[model samples]
Target: MDIHRFFPPHEGISLSDLSGLCGAELADPSQVDRKVTGIGSLSQAGEGEVTFAVSAKNLPDLAKCRAAAVFVTEKMAEHVPSDVAALIVAAPQSAFARAAAILVPDALKPLSFTSDTGISGAATIDPSARLEDGVVVEANAVIAAGVEIGAGSVIAAGAAIGPGTRIGRDCHIGHAATVQHALLGNNVVIHPGARIGQDGFGYVPGPRGLEKVPQIGRVIIQDQVEIGSGTTIDRGALDDTVIGEGTKIDNLVQIAHNVRIGRHCVIVAQVGIAGSATLGNGVMIGGAAGINGHVTIGDGAQIAALSGVAGDVPPGVRWGGQPARPMRGFLQDAAAANARAFGKKERKRGGED
Candidate 1:
């Protein structure tokens, strides 16, 4: 795949210079002058691109890689082809990530709907709203009364900022997105069509029928967070719903009331985190995973795709399947069940014969 479609390469850097930026050591000093033009995966990388291999299993694939340079660990150095330059690092993936940031800084910036730097004439900014210098409010966007937006933030076209909402510097509220009863930190990016701080599903069974419970808590989004398009983060019922710094949430994810996500968590598309669920730092929830309410996922835990998590997950473990047991245990149980089924089928066929 051509990475240029998502992040265009603007400038080329020598392998030596790139190594310095990413804390990688050049395997061969002679190849330091090799020019890297873009970044891609090991399978897709070609000439002038840089890629990385994180494990020994990936080392064999290096022979097929056509990249100008690759980031690898010391143990995998021997498998690197002679023609491909090797940049040794303790963590190949992390080094490649750093290199990408350095080479394509613009890729990190949020998409802007307009080039205009000030409030558009078509926008509806209340008289009581306070916008700092360099704040951009696009056409038809609504800034409610008592809203305070910091400098360099962009409220995109047709977006709505609720009354008393506080947005920090360099934030981007995408087109048609709505944010209410929220406090957003610097460099936060809320993508187009995202709905934040809406009332959660809260009700009590009363004598008459179901009684609605008031949702009065706010949503607090910390610095450098990116909430994806069409994602819904409901407001807390009592305490605040908090999204920690540097968390990247994919499109169509649902974060219910009082969900507390920790720093640098990766929540993939269609993941549903129920109310009061707490995810620890560096936790990764795979696509379509369901996290039950009040569950605590420990730091660095990984939930496999489509898994149903019904209880607390321990730190740094991989879990999968219904109820989300340890991956190894789940795999063992599946294999045993398969073997039993196969044996039973053979026995029944022999008896019929």
Candidate 2:
């Protein structure tokens, strides 16, 4: 497919300009004026487009590429077609990513889902709600009393902003999302179906039954944080649950009460962080990892997919396993366990002998 039919193509950026934008060098100055209007994969890119090749495996594809320009390292530069402009860079993929930001800027953030220029007539805005000049409240959205939304923010269709909530400028609350008892910073993005500021799973055994504890705390999402679709962040029990600036949480994640996630952390999809868990800056958690309650993951640590974290993770290390531990020990244990279960026969992935 033609993605241009859906996302549309950029007007055009010359190869000379793209080299500077991507921090790459224009090796062939003669073809510097060649324009790139879009980007595609190695096998799929056509005329007036750009792509990148990072390794030897891409040589075959590079030879057949018909794009206007391609980003490559010096070693791979010879494989690029003579007709195609070669933008040489230390990291081809990184250069391509930079180019994508400039080329497909609309894909970076959600735009207006409807034709709404301002607050739609069908939206329910309370008399006490305060919206900035450029705020766009889409159809069927509900703005409760005392809610304050900043300029350039978009409350998409069916979103609900509860009373007294404060949203900063240039934020986007997605379709069908709910925000209550929360304070969102500038440039925050909550994708469609995200549930924010909900009650934590807190209860106590009473004489009659389990009694719900008062969830009086709020969620504080700092600037540039992006919560993915279907993610749920529970409100704190007493203290605020804070997401630091530039942290990106993927879809289907569950962040429980009192969680404090640090700046620039990357939490992958389906991860479950229990109550009171703290993650330090630059910590990267892979998909489906389960973090136990009250645990702390230190800065620059990485957790593998499907791992289970029991306690504190030290700074600047990698951990993986059912009960997560250092990678060295975890790998040894895994090999032994696998041998015992599978008759000590080494096999490739998918059990191929």
Candidate 3:
């Protein structure tokens, strides 16, 4: 598809005209006639493109930029070269987004079924699963026998859905990503290699070594939650393993049974949360961070990369290191290592030098 055709030449508006769009007063009306095609970064902008300077630090790059026009704050107006046309807005970055929309119009296609697709005649589907124009549903990609899927939700070969799994619009279920007996909110993406709703890791030590415990719970994923490739979420041992709304689970993330995560949390790649671990809202667990079983992380807590969290974390704290204390405490311990060497140096200088 031709992108230029989508954004066919409309009478180009200028920086002075942009002020009304973004609620900014233009410093100079005479400099508004420069024609702008689209928006680009300061480093990559060329003729016919417009760029922005967000702060004083970005002013130097904006000055040397070769774009047709540049968006600048009131304070950075002096740094704009005489040859360049300035958009001159209080919030230049916001103006850039608005301007880019005008220049780059969306080319959305109508939804339809293609000739190269396959569908199972016996598969039951809800009336709301809107398949887009080019979507391919393989044989037996059960649409959950009430699942309203948006355009382009591809169900791979041999994938089955449990009843009442409401998949929102535009979700891609990889080949055999087992989603059963749960509700998947809108725009929730699951990778191909993931195994969802499997039995949890529960066992009781018996006379020999251990005895297996039954996992009889569901995995509830909210809107915009992405399960990475090869990642797995176990079914709850008793209750559900609830992934909070807008939370992102990275590749290879292992969320054990009955783990409750809060909204908008970031669980990075290779991070493992044992059974029944609870993370509060807006929590960020860095890459390779490990949380032990049954611990609760309070709201807005941040775990640094590769940290091992054995105990509970309080609210609004940044934790790092092995045991994962506050960031300040970890830095202090790192600084004190040099103090120990300094103490040995002072003792040797005083006596056994």
Give the candidate number with the greatest TM-score: 2
- Expressed as tens digits, the lDDT of each residue in 1-353 for candidate 2 is 55678678899999988999899998889988889989899888999889999999998898899888889999888888898899999999999999988988888887677999899999999999999999999999999999999999999999999999999999999999999999999999999999999999999999999999999999999999999999999999999899999999999999999999999999999999999999999999999999999999999999999999999999999999989999999999999998886764544434873
Which stretches in model 1 have alpha-carbon errors above 4 Å? 1-6, 56-61, 314-318, 345-353
In order of lDDT, best first, we have 2, 1, 3
Q: For residues 246-316, what per-residue lDDT tens digits would candidate 1 score against the true structure?
A: 99999999999999999999999999999999999999999999999999999999999999999999999
TM-score against truth, every candidate: 0.89, 0.94, 0.68
* Global fold similarity of model 1 (TM-score): 0.89
* Alpha carbon lDDT at 22, candidate 2: 90
The C-alpha local distance difference test score for the whole of candidate 3 amounts to 0.76
Better of 1 and 2 by TM-score: 2
**Residue 324 displacement (Å), model 2:** 0.7
| Clashing residue pair totals per candidate (backbone < 3 A) | 0, 0, 3
lDDT tens readout by residue for model 3, 1-353: 53355345446777666656766665567766667766678877777777788887896687688887777887887887777776677788888787777776442211222332545464456565554454556655666645545455666655666655656666667666677656677677787667788888888999998999988788888887878878889879889999989898888899899999999999899999999999999999999989999999999999999999999999999999898999999889978988999998999899965
- Model 3 segments beyond 4 Å from truth? 1-42, 45-164, 174-176, 338-353
